[model samples]
Target: MKKKINPSREWYVLYVKSRHERKIEALLKENNIETFLPLVKTVREWSDRKKIIESPLFPSYLFVKIDFRKESEKVLAIRGFCFFVRFGTEFAKIQEHEINSIKLLMEIDASMEVENNHIQPQVGELRKIEIGALGGLGCEIIKVNNENKIIVRIDSINQNILATIPSSYLTQLATV
Candidate 1:
């Protein structure tokens, strides 16, 4: 009997060659595969001038929506494709809400910074944003330069989104 393929589609992270995120996204789109490449704009100063350019929020990483069991070979065959982000032996699957949260952050155009490999020991109280554009998001408060900052951890991606939020907007969550 042939092995079964899952028909349901889900989001999975793909690791691609350095600086090849846009290229991979285009290639996947051409093949009718759904992809999400989150990008952010920043000003870069050159020796002669300064210009604003858009760059991938997460370097060398992008998200794909597919039934891995069905499309694994095709996706892997693409040029610049490295491998799927995995946890131990199993592939890492991203939650839809997490994707939406990222989208929401981008939509609001919030001043944000991405910290990769944020595996430091957890510090400070876990609080929820109660006001402003970031309201409803759970974050951890950390002291940066003697000032409080909120870190929204996207555990699956091993990243932390650092943003400066006013103290009044934060409410400490009751520990169980």
Candidate 2:
């Protein structure tokens, strides 16, 4: 039997308690609510040893695909849920493509690597990251090391994470 789809159900962004994103996601799923908490696997360095852990890509935020009219209160009742992000009087809706994009980014293995020396360019060329963890972000390629490793500054996220992506994944922006 085919399950009926609810046309009103859309992806909505929610702010949850700090450090409680995963817990809330588990709770919502137990209650039969569809939730998406995008996470990234990274190496965490400690004084003694290094540990690889999965952390939320966007801290304190998760998306729920639900019929807001019927399930808003149920979502709010979850202990860690803070509130829905609002755009004017209405709750902000996340485009389906954006959610899919984030999922695709997390799936990419970019070998998150960084070079110590900061490369500065006289004039930087703007380009888009077509693949890897920082996909969809616009970066300025400041330096290309032997044509294999290029230094780029991702301007969208306030703090940039260093990752090594193949140059073939980059697309040069045409001059406007």
Candidate 3:
């Protein structure tokens, strides 16, 4: 039996109706369920004006923290909340680091890569990162493509998403 704790919170992602992401998020928050919706800032044009909007990076998806094994039924019964992300019999836990990254990312202009795998990092802003357990290595981040993959070149090996670095254990690479 899953142990029940008063605040047995673990990060989880829920699939919801697209465009209903914010609505579901608001509703859940009102219910005392802590939630997070990762979004990217973009401009949307109305008839007379162009307005900036924060839109979901992952459509139909939102993250939350709750004691699911104990409160699973409550979360599932929520209208418009499609389902909790799962793997077979267990609800998968969202990496805490991802939560932190998403929070910090919201405060800055960001880009993602995956399908259209190309990153054209700005000239002065190009940062060479010596990361991971490889001791010290060089990586260049350019454009944030559609796939959310960070294109990095390590020792002439072009890689989509540097395979080694922990997003949290980063130290700045000194300029030559």
Candidate 4:
């Protein structure tokens, strides 16, 4: 059966191997596939010196939007490029709002306000932080947007891209 997907296709998450996110993304782009990788810049320091690095906001995962024919050879070839996130025999579909939230975060690079489930910045409100430390964990927020940093950061080193709490977490110290 030919796989059918409509126009205005939403983003899909792929399960590429750890450390392959950037390369697979590059390969997909080389093949004209639309992809999005949310990233942030942070200064990494060592005894020698400090360096600014641009890193993926979500580690080990990248988003792609494309229509594939189920029986098409390219689809399988793309799958063979790396591991595909699966639910039994299917590539798992990433939640739309999650991707939206990330894009929204990337767009803003200034102070943001956090109240309830919303993150308000000079640009606009992005996806509501419905889960995790900002929402799901049910702890008092440390801060909203800390210097354009996505703290309580994520590790790109693994395919899971799990969130890690910062040693000095965000907290609402004062208000305007």
Candidate lDDT values, in order: 0.79, 0.71, 0.59, 0.50
Candidate 1: C-alpha lDDT = 0.79
* Lowest lDDT block of 10, candidate 3: 155-164
TM-score of 2: 0.69
In angstroms, give how far residue 157 of model 4 lies from its true place. 17
Tens digit of per-residue lDDT, candidate 4, span 70-146: 32234346643555556567655555554554565566542344333333332221222343334322123333443
lDDT string, candidate 2, 74-151, tens digits: 898898679997767878777666676567667876554443343322226566677665566666665556333334
Instruction: Identify the leading candidate in terms of TM-score.
Output: 1
Q: Native-vs-model 2 lDDT?
A: 0.71
Instruction: For each of the candidates, give the backbone clash count.
Output: 0, 0, 12, 7
- Misplaced by over 4 Å in model 4 are 1-5, 70-80, 110-176
The top-ranked prediction according to lDDT is 1
lDDT, model 1, position 43 = 96
> Which residue pairs in model 2 clash with each other?
none
The candidates, ranked best first by TM-score, are: 1, 2, 3, 4
* Clash tally for model 4: 7
As for TM-score, the candidate ahead, 2 or 3, is: 2
As for TM-score, the candidate ahead, 3 or 4, is 3
Instruction: Give the true-structure RMSD of model 3.
Output: 10.3
**Candidate 2, position 176, lDDT:** 78
